[model samples]
Target chain A: MALAIKELLAVLKDKKGRIVLIMPPILQLFLFGYAASFDLNDIPVAVYNQDQGADSRELVARVIGSPHFHLYADIDHEQQISSLINNKNVLIVLHLGPNFSANLAKGPGTSAQVIIDGRNSNTALLVQGYLSTIVSDFNVDWAKRNGKPPPLASLKLRAWFNSNMVSRWFIVPGIVGLLTFIITTIVTSLSVAREREAGTFDQLLVTPMRPVEILIGKSFPGVLIGSLEGSFILLMAIYWFDIPLRGSLGALYIGMFLFILSAVGIGLMISSLAVTQQQGMLGAFLFMVPAVILSGFATPIANMPQVVQWLTYADPLRYFLIILRGVFLEGDNSSILMHYYWPMAVIAIVTLSLAAWLFRHRMN
Target chain B: MSPFAKRFMRLRGLIRKESLQILRDPSSIAIAFVMPVVLLLLFGYGVSLDAKDIRLALVVEQPDAQTSSLTSAFHHSTYFKSITFHTIQPAERALVTHVVDGIVWLRSDFSARLLNHGDAPIGVFVNGVDANQARITQGYIQGVWQTWLQAYARQQGHDLAIPVRLEPRIWFNAAVRSTDFLVPGLIALIMTLTGAMLTSMVVAREWERGTMEALMVTPIRIWEITVGKLLPYFILGMGGMLLSVAMALWLFNVPLRGSFLVLSLASALYMMVALGMGLLISTVARSQFVAGQIALVATFLPAFILSGFIFEISSMPAPVQVMTHLIPARYFVAILQTVFMAGDIWPVLLTNAAALLVMMVIFLGLARHKTRKRLD
Candidate 1:
């Protein structure tokens, strides 16, 4: 315990080191929180209302009035539609037909053209949905006001866990897990390797410290630093970012502790295997890139193929992401979390034991 | 030997030495070759936002031919895998437990109301943990319902034409494959990892081993050493870039719409900036750990987040959008996407290439200044 404190103090003693450790998570949280959003707002839409009538004007009004879209262009010619979309001046172009009002009263053949730039098809799809909702809302209101039958059917849609369906609610909790994973894994994996590279490993080894004691000493700082980073991000998510935490604090901490243990164990294994700190950093980088991709931080695991989904079983971050998101979003209980918890616990044990064995074996 | 010839010979020797060292380091080889392939495969297969076969529960409050036909429509949908239930409580529970992504419930008077009038509303509950997916599922549900309505109306011999038939024409990617959007971004990301993250340790490793003093005693100028050190990694990065381009074109089937010459030119320009940034990072941080961490924070994070690769920059908050202009990968990502999907749009290519050249000059100038022969 005393030796672990000494090691922790050594890392924290330098002001630059301490600041590097503390400042990055806060900055990353602030940057990514503001930048990473798929929610469509201020999407520029071009209007080519050839109709010039009241109904067509009303449709354009509703489109421009929605908070999601901005009126970027008012076009008179058909050629402008292609030019607007091609130049990426607008995401979507809404063109009401020449006889839009005349055909609306007659019914059944009025056509409106929607041209979307599909380079970012995901954004385009969302824009289309938002526009469809607006047009359909106008349709329902117009029909009811005219004392006519409502159009085909209405969908009563409700989002269950996230009522507002905010993407940040899902992405913010993920940053907590991802930031801690990258920071702790890189920092600790470089620890023993840095000692070796600096020619201090021999001095540490010459002491009376047992291999197990040395392993414990080394692993604790990683776990401690990881927990600190995690706590900082979690606090930011709750207090600063204004994301709600619906799960119990006890369950959340337990999951975070196990996740840190697993992450530290992996870093230590890499550290022991690496002959130099450069190799250690590279090794950690290699793992981190794959780990973050496979962990479903930015993408959903359910969308992955069955074989790849099975492969994600080995990644600790996969389980950790599920645990963190479930806790944050769903308020999922300990029993439900246990299904993910035990795998992380097993990974922690196996990797830590492996790192310990490798360390002792290298010394021998 | 003339001064220029002498410099060339010395540069060749340094390149040979750096290549030998890179070959000795197994990790370097893994990162150069193996890492990109693994990342390409992982990203190509795993990182897709396109939803398919979304599991849904269909609740039928009343059993009849019309309702059965509607249920069959959802079951037959390529986008949905549906299970039928007689009540709402179990389906709602399924949605809550995440056993189903969504639930479609038909009221008891669904068929009767449709026959009596022309409209019948259905209730939908979707798990919105992933808001994007939930939104897509909602759109798919609406599409399938519309299709069913059209089919039923046609079978009933009613004129199916409606007011304002929306003809949505999707350009650039007619099929709307997510791969088309994501693969171009992968090229930028892979280059950032190899070009910046790998080379970040080269000079720092020398400094950490106390070998910089010995090297400084040699006859090599700073530019010769920097060029020689950067050339091999530049080749390695270009090779990785080609490999990613090939994989994106052949394996993932993302079309290479632009000229290969222009694509390679943009990549080379971007590589110069990345290599210069790496050199600067290694020069600033004497320790390999600090160098690597700084390189990651400076290059990789910004490449992933600030680049309009995953998230749209125009939609970001104003300050972050301004901050993105400083990141070099933002330009490369724009170049890769335009070249890959949208053909040779020279304005985008030239403008971004100019930006990359400016960044390369700044970073290389800073690196050269930092790597001066004074042993400070």
Candidate 2:
């Protein structure tokens, strides 16, 4: 046991290996902390108030008062809005019809129009929410002026698991997905490249260890290191970021185990094929970028075009994110686990098998 | 033969060798062409700002034709797919619990009030947790309801005055397909990653592998060795640029508004800046691992974040915007946008090109100074 501890310490003391294990997670934490944000501010908006009435002017004033929105211009023509939306300049267009005030004074079925650019669905959705609240508040003011009973009794809002909507709540779980890919891919790629560079790969092949054992051993460090980094990020999320982990720890670990296995498998395959460290790095990046984009990290899978959504099934990060979000945010039970388990299991098997096959073939 | 011609021929040979090395690697070829298409497709469809499948609850104080019509509109609108009509008390409970995004209340005298006053206001209560999405949803509801009112007015034998008609013409991206804008930026990002990360490690890897010591002993001039080492990566970077441009024009159908000659020249100049930055990092670090890390932090991250490739720099904090001036990708992105969208505005192109040239000269000079003959 003492000898085993010494061996572990020796491995840890190796500067390159230690950096290879430590740097990716630290870099990822810093990047994710700074870059990944959901708070939508400085939203561009256009107003087209045709009412030309006192009511229309008041409505415009109210909208401009909100800090979340920035009114770009008062467009006179409808065609201008299309250009603005297309160029991503204005996200929402408000068209207040003639007699808008007259209709509101008469009150019960009056209406106005707002056209939204749907290209960036997430931002559009949030803008929609903000508009509704503004209008609701306006309704209350209008009711008080007319001496009408308040519209209904009262309003109450309860946000579920992530009550605060802290960016960290969503982001910390996602780090598990991002870190898994970064650490596993970099470590495995570097390990294989190191062997090739040192000319020790051929010597290793002469040993009795089968290609599968060698593949497993090489991949083991990556998976272990990825999980360790993931755990560290998870702890930071809970302790430093103050995001609550409502789900069972056991379940999170199990999902992480499967995610690491699939990620390491992919890294091992790239490493086996890459002849140099540069190629290994490029190869890993080529795979990693697409994997993250398709994983629904920055966007929603359901919003994707049908064909692209179908392609996400092949991505392991997609399944892992669903499990992570579901378990951490919803505290969902085994049913959610069941939904993603088979997909993750299939990915692990396929990727590991491919890595094993490539390891043996590349050796020959 | 001139001395310059002799040096140029040697450099050309080095460039050819580098191109062959890149072509031999199938992964590099795939990354050059296939990765951009994959990114375009993914971003085109996956990144959207529209909301769908919103759950809604409706409450009516009075059971009348007018109240029912308003409730039905909420149910049938494409923006909201699932809706339930409930009593006022139950709908209030649903809104607080976030089981539904919004609640619409139809007053007891809805039809009577509308018939008497020409129009009546229906109350809508929205949860404000995601304020932006709520605003957009409100806009959608208002737009749809106004359209309904216009049609109703036409049926009533009253000619509705078209209050305002907006005529919008999108200048560059007529279809406003996000892919058209994103593909060019992706090219910038890919070049940064490949040129900087790959070349930065090359000299450093040589030092790490003990190959630089042997190469240094040869009677090669400093400029020749630096240019020769860079020649191969410059060719590879050009190949990546072409692959991305071809994908943008052919697969995505984005127009090449500017002259191809200008685009190629600008891209080639930008490659020098990128490759020189890498070589400088590699020479200074002299260790492949450290060089890779430095390249990613200094080059790749800034290119993606601060270059206005993904996020608008104008919206960033004042300090961040000031910091972005140092990132090379910012100039590259401006050049690419001007070429693709604005038909190669000469003034913009000239300023960007000069900036890139200055950066290249600085980096290349630093690289030359750092590539020492000593093994220590």
DockQ by candidate, in order: 0.70, 0.16
Instruction: Supply candidate 2's per-residue lDDT for B144.
Output: 54
Query: Candidate 2: misplaced stretches above 4 Å?
Result: A1-17, A42-65, A69-169, A210-216, A333-335, B1-6, B23-27, B41-176, B203-205, B255-266, B285-294, B315-322, B334-358, B372-376
Report the lDDT tens digits of candidate 1 across residue range A183-214.
78976797788777777877887899887888
lDDT of 2 by residue, A1-364 (tens): 3323432353366576577467656765755655555555566779887777776788778777787678898988878876665444566777787778777666543555777654323434455566666776776676667775443222333333545444556666777677777777777766676667667877767878787777777766776668877888878777776655666777777888888888877887887887777667777777887788888775556556778778889888988887776666767555547767778788888878887777657853
Chain A, model 2: TM: 0.75
* Candidate 1 CAPRI classification by DockQ: medium
In the range B268-347, model 2's lDDT, one tens digit per residue, is 88888898899888877777766876787688877876776655554555566687787789888877876776576676
Candidate 2, position A56, lDDT = 72
How displaced is residue A13 in candidate 2, in Å?
A: 5.7
For residues B278-328, what per-residue lDDT tens digits would candidate 1 score against the true structure?
Answer: 988888887676777788788988899889888888788888889999999
